[model samples]
Target: MKKQIYIVGLILFGLLSCVQKHTKDKIESNQSRIFHYNNEPYLIKGICYHPVPKGSDQRSFETIDQDLELMVEAGINTIRVYEPIDDIDVLDKINSAGLKVIIGFGYNQNGNYDILSGSFIDYVKKYIDHPSILMWELGNEYNYHPEWFNDDITNWYKALNESAALIQEIDKKHKVTTAHGELPDALALKMTDRIDVWGLNIYRWDNPSELFEQWEKVSEKPMYLSEAGGDSYMTITKQGYEEGFNEKAQADANAKILESIFNNREVCSGVTMFSFTDGWWKAGDTDTQDIGGWAPNSSGVPYDGTPNEEFWGIVDIDRNKKETYVVIKNKYKQTLTEY
Candidate 1:
């Protein structure tokens, strides 16, 4: 009888250990380093803004506040701003508005790449404590020219790992991601391990479904669309905006691309459209060969007039929601209900 009791006790202990292990796994899987109001993954949906520097008399805090209020009402929980080197007050305003921020690092002009100077450790220590920060993006589209950094792909990975390590050491709660342009399966293998999540920028010419399928095969991590949409010009020019080939065409393409991603919720985390407004840089301007097809020249230079129809914003420069915005809102509503 004593021997039988000892066997039963061993079985009970084993079961208890299994239960504890399972509980721990569940907790870690659901943990979010960013904003967690009630231990649930905060569903972040929002837009990205071009760098709006503080004390730019043209851009006021009140303007930003109004925009944030609009976004929150539209069901957005976060906003990823361009990497601001020094703008604590603006950061505070963002936090006060109740939106999480994904801070970007690393900037390159032409082929020159530069990490934020100073002790990497000090940089992490300074901002890790900020309540609004959600994640750290090592760079935007840094993989575009790996040869520029170092001909060796391994060197790029090492750099990414180093940056990620610094951020993790200071703030383990926040996640790390890197934005990359879509390429055939052969090219993406280079930077897969360097990032926690994948940031893909898609143009109108590319099929969203096809791109998603190719990336999904090799990557199990969540993905987000860092940039999307094309020039909305009515006229088509080779050097001008090419995504949709025209305004209505661009809008229609945007709707289709977004719909495809939304339907496949299991693999996608979320998407941030290319921009909120027309900016001075004419990269999206169609008239300039240097700037390429992303921008159409409707509003003309310096963005002084009613933004041209080619400007791919849910709202025109006038700040009116377009058909694309309606489609987006409807799709968002459907997703919330279904998910």
Candidate 2:
């Protein structure tokens, strides 16, 4: 019995050692393409990742690791979250997985915010020196809220400039960015002098080149496809594919936009494909925008377009590949290496 106990102890010790080594091996020192770790162009293949368990809304560390490993395999180097996470170790684990992170210092867990309601500076200070950090994002889509800028545009710029100044003051090493649903006005654009990267979260399926051309006219700064993807193309069946949903359309759209990014490589910094997993929590009870707290719907329903919000993912909740998964993997693998 004593010998058996000794063997079990040894096994536990081995497991612990393996865990430590794995984490260390995964945490790599990679410089950004835009920021230039060593003047190397870092083509950002990122994902807007927020994965909770299928049945529950609570995020599982095990699932996070699993999803991240898959992302790394998919050639995704970065993961952008809307806000700082509650778990510090999870962020560490993300770094250990050889992936970079861009934390958005926004109000609440999601996009909407009142600048005074939260502490943006403290948020920046928390992860300023962390190795995995790539950029500090300010506000998600302030253009959607008229109150954020209104007629004056001062409310928006003041928050961006103030928060950005604080971030740079805390960590001169990292970059600061702001996301707009579309484009900001001239005054707001003029006030964005403090920001390093200009983020555009667009859904227009038109020619991406035209979009980049429009951007170049206003801001010559480095920019990225922070959040750009389409809803599920659910049409029962099309061509040889028969998933009831037209994932091929999604695949085509994602591929085209990425192709456009590559074609406009001189100006485009990188791409963060809208999402990793389809968060059902966004669907709420009916098919509507998620204004409520982040909670999984009581019903475990697969995305079909009733609520388009739940279908903007490369993979489903189970981490199974949607057609866009292969499209993204191929696009990322080719662009970052070949280009």
- Per lDDT, the best of the predicted structures is 2
Q: Which digits, one per residue and each the tens of the lDDT, describe model 2 over residues 79-145? A: 9887666578888888898889888766444432324554666656666677788888887777666
Q: Candidate 1 on 196-314: residue-level lDDT in tens?
A: 66666665352467766665676666676776654454443433345332445555656677676655555556677655554433444333212233322223211121223235555
Residue 29's lDDT in candidate 2: 23
| Candidate 2: residue 7 lDDT (0-100) | 100
Each prediction's TM-score versus the true structure: 0.68, 0.76
lDDT of each: 0.56, 0.69
lDDT of 2 at 266: 61
Clashing pairs in 2: 26-96, 27-96, 33-42, 233-246
